[model samples]
Target: MKAFGSIALAAAVTLGLGGVVLAKPLSRIISETGLSPEDFEVLSATSDSMLASGTPRAGKEREWINESTGSKGTIRVLEVRDNCASLQHFIRPAGVSQTRQIRTRRCRDANGNWILTP
Candidate 1:
């Protein structure tokens, strides 16, 4: 019985579908895209610029401008998968004259939206 329980746990983590995220079947599910680490950074920085509280829809794009400092940028959802999402954020800080790109991921919670996990 103990061994069976352990096996169940292992299976859940492996398939990712059972644990959270996508409603698709086991075969189509994945835990991570393996591109998350680098992508997630850009997403996080850009999302902060939006100053809104909600999950960005997959493929949704938004533009932002900082009125005070005149910094501007864009954020776009690259993709969304079972449990997590990939996003891109571009920013050109005021007075620096350079553009930056950041990519990041967000995991779903009980509320059914992508959010950065602790």
Candidate 2:
């Protein structure tokens, strides 16, 4: 009985942590960042090696360049909290050897819409 109780407690703790990890609010990140849903359309939903490594391995770089500025960066959806969603865009100029992370804050517009601030 004691062993069963321990197992149940462990399962409950694991489930609780999993729920928190999965329950991120992404909408608030978008609204506060001022990134329209349309902008996300151009972003890669998943992290790709080309973007992370800064080398075009297989994907067409031209398409990304044509869609947006020729900026190389990572676009990720970050959930700041339960009520906020944010898209984190990290950009580095082409041909640059070093990488840097840029932060953009989200704010509401006059109509209470979220906007991303540089």
Candidate 3:
């Protein structure tokens, strides 16, 4: 009976780890960042809108907040060129003191859609 219980415990552990390993990459990232899906959505929309606006300029900053999750962030345009813009995101997860920052660049495609660029 003890051996059977050990086997069941091992199986449970394996299944739990397997589920974590199989989680979608984006979901894992969001979870790691301590941001809810709603918070991420708000951030994405705000960033895209800032980039899509005609003639983005450096020093422009936009803020986003998800009241449901209490997560907030700021997106600032760092640099702008003819077709590409680089921005910084300062993210503050709810109740967390350490803020996270992410820098990314986006360029306008021929069809006028913003695309993330390396």
Residues 1-118 of candidate 3: C-alpha lDDT, one tens digit per residue: 3333223322322233344334244546566667766676677778767866686889999999988889999999999897888777788989899888766677888998666655
Query: Which RMSD does model 2 reach against the true structure?
Result: 19.0
Instruction: For each candidate in the order shown, give its overall lDDT on alpha carbons.
Output: 0.48, 0.36, 0.69
lDDT of 2 by residue, 1-41 (tens): 33332233223222332333333344543343333333333
lDDT of 3: 0.69
Could you give candidate 1's per-residue lDDT for residues 1-118 as a string of tens digits? 3333223322333333233443443233212221122232333444644324555568788876656556666778787677666656565655656676555555767876445432
Candidate 3, position 115, lDDT: 67
lDDT score for residue 40 of model 3 = 62
lDDT of model 2 at position 117:
32
Ranking of all predicted structures according to TM-score, beginning with the best and ending with the worst: 3, 1, 2
lDDT ranking from best candidate downward: 3, 1, 2
Q: State which candidate has the highest TM-score.
A: 3
Model 3 misplaced stretches (Cα beyond 4 Å): 1-24
Worst 10 residues of 3 by lDDT: 5-14
Candidate 1: stretches off by over 4 Å: 1-57
Clashes of each: 9, 14, 0
